[model samples]
Every structure is written in C-alpha cells, then in structure tokens.
Target: MPTPGFPPSTLDAGGGPIWISELASDDPNHAVHVVRDLEPADALEALGAKPRLFRPCELPRSKPDKWTSLPAAALGIEPGEVPPG
Candidate 1:
C-alpha cells in the first residue's frame, strides 16, 4: 500500500516523495550521489556551485536517467547505464 505524502509504487518502487534539484556529478559515467537528508548549503557544496536561482517543482516519479538522456540521444551520444538506486 502507498503511504500518504508518497509516490505510488508503480511510479517509484522506493515509494517515497520524489524531489527535483539541479544535481551534479564528478564522474561522467555515474549519477550524482548526495545524501537525501542534506541541508541546502551542503547540496550546493556537493555540486561545487555558488548560489543560483531555481524554482522548485515536482513531477511524477519515473526513471529519470531515461528521459534526462534524451538530448544526448538526439545528438547520437549513447545513453550511459544507470544502476538501480
């Protein structure tokens, strides 16, 4: 059963509310890895970025790597493998 304030299992097997952010990774072959319970400042440090403007929004939970790679795919860049989170 799905919990209140959480995404359904069909959308996200983890069955938790999904969050969106501007994530950054040092490794080109891997997804950005940041602890879920990070403070906003900590998250910014992880991205090696200074404060920037962003509007928070939510979307249906889905395999993000698939869609996030669309632009690369259009440019004929092979999609990288995304390990199960």
Candidate 2:
C-alpha cells in the first residue's frame, strides 16, 4: 500500500517496499543521477555536459518599478515538455 503524497510500490521478498528495484528501473527522463549536488559550472565539468537549473518562480516576477525581460533560453523548452490543452 502506498502512503498519501507518495508513489506506489511493491512488496519486497522480506515484505518491505521494493524501492531499490524501482529506482534501478526509474524513468530516464524523470531521474537525476548526480555524484554530488554540484554548482552549474562544477556539474558541467564533472559530467562533461551542460547542466540546466530551474529558476525560482518569484525570480521571474516584475519588480515594483521595472518591466520583466524573459530570456530566450527559458523559452527554448521542447514542444513535448509543454502541457497539453
């Protein structure tokens, strides 16, 4: 049985939730495999790949006297990543 606010799971041989097996087969698109929580530059160096970090929602809001300018990179998400109507 799954607890409220948690994902479903199966019973292990010893009757515990089978978390390890589930993690081993985790969805590639949803999983984040990191040796450590590294900063953007450090993470790129360690993984030899660019690292993407989500910005805080409040960070994008316009200030009291200023207009907001959204970055093109923020609008470069894949079409499939957008929510369906």
Candidate 3:
C-alpha cells in the first residue's frame, strides 16, 4: 500500500536527505527522494491559496521571472568587462 501525504523514504543511500512524496508520479519504477530542509510547513503555508504542485517534468529550469533581470555573473560578463568605479 502507498502512503498518503508521506514522501518516499531515502535512507542509507549515501546521498542527502530526500522526501518521497515530492517524487513525480509518472515514474513509479524509479525511487523518489528530496534533500533535507527542502520542505517546511511554514514555507508551504506561505503559499496561501496558491500552493504549487510538483510534476515529473515541471522541475524549474531557472529562477522565477521576477529575478531574471538581476545581474548575475553566471549569465555572462568577464571581470574587466564589468563597469568600474
């Protein structure tokens, strides 16, 4: 029987802590796990009426839209190319 509201168990895998519940349902054959501290009740409650649901392929490829404009070296720009005071 599958456990409801309970994430999968990832014990003794030598990786990090993982939540089984967050695993995508599409791949039942593969085990699901999540890093520790990734989930918190307070964080979920912050979502209020718009709680996000995780899907197999719905994993985020990048940061949220609001943060896209922020200056980030990873996007590009050599050290000297940046404006200096």
Candidate 4:
C-alpha cells in the first residue's frame, strides 16, 4: 500500500478517458490504476478481471525461434496449455 502522506499527482485533462486507460495499462483492476474516467472502467471491473500486464507495443509474450512464428493473440501460452476459465 502506498503511504498516506504520499502526494497525489495531478492529471492533465486533454484526451478522452481512453488515453488515461491506456496509460493505466487499460486495466482498471490493477493496483497502479490511474483513473480519469470512472463510468466505463467501473463496468468492466464489475465483470471480474485479473490485473494483467499490458504491452503497448503489441509484442508476443514469448520469444520465437528460427522455425516457429506465433501470433500475438496466443499470449506465448500454448492453446491446450491453459485450462478454460
């Protein structure tokens, strides 16, 4: 937890809430969430989501070798490797 004496950083309001969400890793459930908009973010959070690390560069989660090229959506985890939620 952050110390209560820590000062709150002020936000510059310019772009839409989308921009704030992007900077906050687009995941409101994260501990480091910086919320500029509450409506939409609240809806998504009510649905239950884990705080996931965001990759702004859209890179795949795993390193690919000489013979294999993987899609970004695969998340570096094999299809059958993870059980259904």
Candidate 5:
C-alpha cells in the first residue's frame, strides 16, 4: 500500500516511542517531519491520528537546509586532509 505523502521508511509496528523523519521524502533537503501526538483539547488523548496520513513538510526556505548542510569542515579535518589508513 502506497502512503499518500509519507514515505515507506516511516512505517513501523507502532505502540512505542514515536519517531519522525523525512530522509526519504521528495526534495529531502527541504523536507521535515512533524510529530503531533497530542491534542490540546485533551491532553490525555493520543491525538488519534495516523502518521502516514500526515503531510510532509515542504515549506519554502533558504538554500542548504539542515538535512543537506553537513560540511566536511565541521569534522575537524583540513581542506586537503585525507583519512588515515
């Protein structure tokens, strides 16, 4: 079964710690996962919603979003430094 906007990677057995990801979404660089598991009206409720039915975060923003902003320089390696064998 194909989930509308959610990717297959979000599918899990359910009933445990909640997790959200957008690595498999289209335009993943701009994609994000929002987990809303509580309803303000009823704090005790489980939101009674399905994650697969949730929409993918596609808001327009500046270039190089968090997911695609990982640079090698952040690893404390010099520009021309190669990995030790």
Candidate 6:
C-alpha cells in the first residue's frame, strides 16, 4: 500500500510541529527566523524520504530565543548601580 513516487507519511497523533533549523546560535544583533512543518505530509514531501519507524524526542514546544521586552530605559526605570540623570 505504498506509493511509488511520493514520499510516505503517517498521521502523528502525539507529537509537536517539526521545525527545520541548523544547530547554531542565532546572532544577537542580526536575528533569524525558523519555519516549522505542522503537517506530516508536508514534512515528508519536503524531505523526499520516509522518516524512521519511531521518532524519538519529537522536540518540546519552542520558547522565545531572545528577550523581546522593551529596554529598561524605555520603561522609565534605571538600574540601581547606574547614576540617575
């Protein structure tokens, strides 16, 4: 029951979205964006090959790579050690 040309895919019931990323830290000054595949078919088609029988550690949900909050100065609150101007 396998297709000849198209890659194989299955319905994953207990996994998270699969992201494609390099194993490198993103530059602080120049940030990078990551894309994830939510559908198994899309992932398999992109890969052009079938995945392993049992995938391990399907990766936990991602957290913010960097702090996106406004700077302390913008918040009108300065640090304790710094002199108040």
Instruction: Point to the candidate with the largest lDDT.
Output: 1
**Per-residue lDDT of 1-85 in model 6, one digit per residue for the tens?**
3332322232122232122221123223443343354565456546564464323233333333343212223343344444233
**Which is the better candidate, 3 or 4, if ranked by TM-score?**
4
Better of 3 and 6 by lDDT: 3
For TM-score, candidate 1 versus 5, the one ahead is 1
Ranking by TM-score: 1, 2, 4, 6, 3, 5
Q: Best-fitting candidate, measured by TM-score?
A: 1
After aligning candidate 6 to the native by TM-score, how far in Å is the CA of 44 from where it should be? 3.1
Superposition error at 30 for model 5 (Å): 19
**Candidate 3 global TM-score:** 0.19
Tell me the spans in candidate 4 whose CA falls farther than 4 Å from its real position: 1-43, 52-74, 83-85
lDDT measured at residue 71 in model 1 versus the true structure, 0 to 100: 30
Can you give the lDDT of residue 31 in candidate 2? 40
Between candidates 1 and 2, the one scoring higher on TM-score is: 1
- What is the RMSD, in Å, between candidate 4 and the native fold over all Cα? 11.5
Please list the residue runs of candidate 3 whose C-alpha ends up more than 4 Å from where it truly belongs after superposition: 1-14, 21-40, 50-85
**Model 3 poorest 10 in a row by lDDT:** 17-26
Backbone clashes in candidate 6 total: 0
lDDT (tens digit, per residue) of candidate 4 on 1-85 = 4333323442334333433434354334444344434654464465565335332245343335533223323355454465233
Q: Candidate 2 or 6, higher TM-score?
A: 2
Preferred candidate (lDDT higher): 3 or 5: 5
TM-score of 5: 0.18
Q: Report how far off residue 77 is in candidate 3 (Å).
A: 50
What tens-digit string does per-residue lDDT give for candidate 3 at 1-85?
3333333355224333333322322234563323335464444445442344421123333333532311223343343464232
lDDT of 2 by residue, 23-43 (tens): 334422344444445675676
Tell me which of candidates 1 and 4 scores higher on TM-score.
1
Q: Residue 81: error of model 1 in Å?
A: 24
